[model samples]
Target: MSAWHRPSSRRDLFRFAASAAACAALPGLARANQRPEAFTSGEIVENGHRFFGSISRGLAEGLEQANKKWGRPNAYILGQEAGGAFVGGLRYGEGKMFTRNAGQKPVFWQGPSIGLDAGADGDRTMMLVYNLPDVEAIYRRYAGVNGSAYLVGGLGFTALNNEEVVVMPVRAGLGARLGLALSYLKFTPDSTWNPF
Candidate 1:
């Protein structure tokens, strides 16, 4: 049998170090990627009030509406946004996607809208996410029509989707707002001024 020997060349030693570092990082990476199991309707409503700092009846109704459409979402985003319009407009926001096992991921989103409702900007968004298979799914563009405000399509329901994943953004300040505009939201890992 051959006995073990020290790595002879610098190249051999470098390769050994690289392999060791990867092996050491494996466990931490696995834990970081773990996903959450589920979300409850009560938690959704409770968090809505807590996140936006109010317990209004309109907010309660809005959350209930989303719950009915997509029961027990697996994820959610809690954050604020800014936008305005006389006719055509643009919107931008940043938030954290909360999944118990996967942890909070900082995500940024921006959308351009035409013929959307004109309103004052306020503490503006929380998204209820459904059928998100994994966190990587969140880093893509989603499309939906926003042609109704509040009760028309269920709580600022900008029902955007990319393949199997569905994202319905609920606005606390508007109570629910939408209009006859086509909007597409592109999510990025980093903050960007470009909303295209």
Candidate 2:
């Protein structure tokens, strides 16, 4: 009806097409960028029992706290690790990353800590994975803090992150270890003694 209401020129038509294309693509882009569906509390609790052999008070506490703070997880790592901290220390663990979209792959992680910390023992570790876009994305450095140890020794609520991916490790009845440390965990495809 009017010049402003209709495509008046070739340039205007091209711009309109571009806008339409972008709008059409928005949904796919959103789907592509969306992280996988997270694990529910019921699922986590069941898996937690299976992973740790039994659900303890420490495990329950950590899981509840983590779930409340970060929602849920789309992937997870079940493994064992050992380290002792006396002022500074290193931790190493190997496990398999399980994801509905990416299947499962072996993963190894090592981390170093520094603070007024002390203790040592090896324990089974279950890391609840969140914001993981893919399996390969898990292989990166995630910095975290063991700021507190709950219910004696079940440490599971520590948040390790690399801006994009977050791994919340939940360990229960692992050992007689305790301390507070700022740490960075580097995950790799293979095992290495290096903790840097």
Candidate 3:
């Protein structure tokens, strides 16, 4: 009883109250800074069409082709653009990338092509992205092969590959075009006119 002690002074009680308040606030601070977990499949499917619009029959068929040819994708990008070619061609577009973990991020892509390709066209594109470790993995160059383009009912799609990541770009547009060209798309943080 002689050795027993408690917070008997006003200063000691104030110190104890301050320490308890800080400990209670720690969890909320940690939660606020943490990144959210991956998105669910339903959320991805719902938002896919929300950004890209209702899929057309041709586009659906094209997606099936991509799924059968390439594997299922973990993410997708929705964009729109216009371009044409004579001997050399350039295309530029703005879009958003959606993944399982990250909700969405703005993306810009541009590229140059050479071949018999010609004609101006404007189209909305949905790129099915595979093997994406994260959203940042999309900011890089993806190369397209010559003579790999496929068209169906006013819609066209082509597959671009960069290491483990594969992007299947599906487009629905209004134009007349014919040619085969090798191209590489550079995804950047913002839009740029420089095609390199």
How many clashing pairs per prediction, in order?
1, 1, 1
Report the candidate with higher lDDT, 1 versus 2: 2
Report the Cα lDDT for residue 123, model 1: 46
lDDT string, candidate 2, 1-196, tens digits: 6635667899999998898899999986665445566777777777778888755556667778877777678988888888778889888999887766546779999989999787776768889988788666888899978764543455456788898677898765455566789999999999999999
Query: What ranges in model 3 sit over 4 Å off?
Result: 1-55, 146-153
In model 2, the runs with Cα more than 4 Å from the true position are: 1-35, 148-156
Q: In order, what lDDT does every prediction score?
A: 0.75, 0.78, 0.73
Each candidate structure's TM-score, on Cα atoms with residue i matched to residue i, is: 0.75, 0.75, 0.71
**Which pairs clash inside model 2?**
156-170
Q: State the local distance difference test value for candidate 2.
A: 0.78
Q: What does candidate 3's lDDT look like per residue over 156-177, in tens digits?
A: 7788889988887877676667
Worst 10 residues of 1 by lDDT: 148-157
Q: Which candidate do you rate higher for lDDT, 2 or 3?
A: 2
Question: Best lDDT goes to which candidate?
Answer: 2
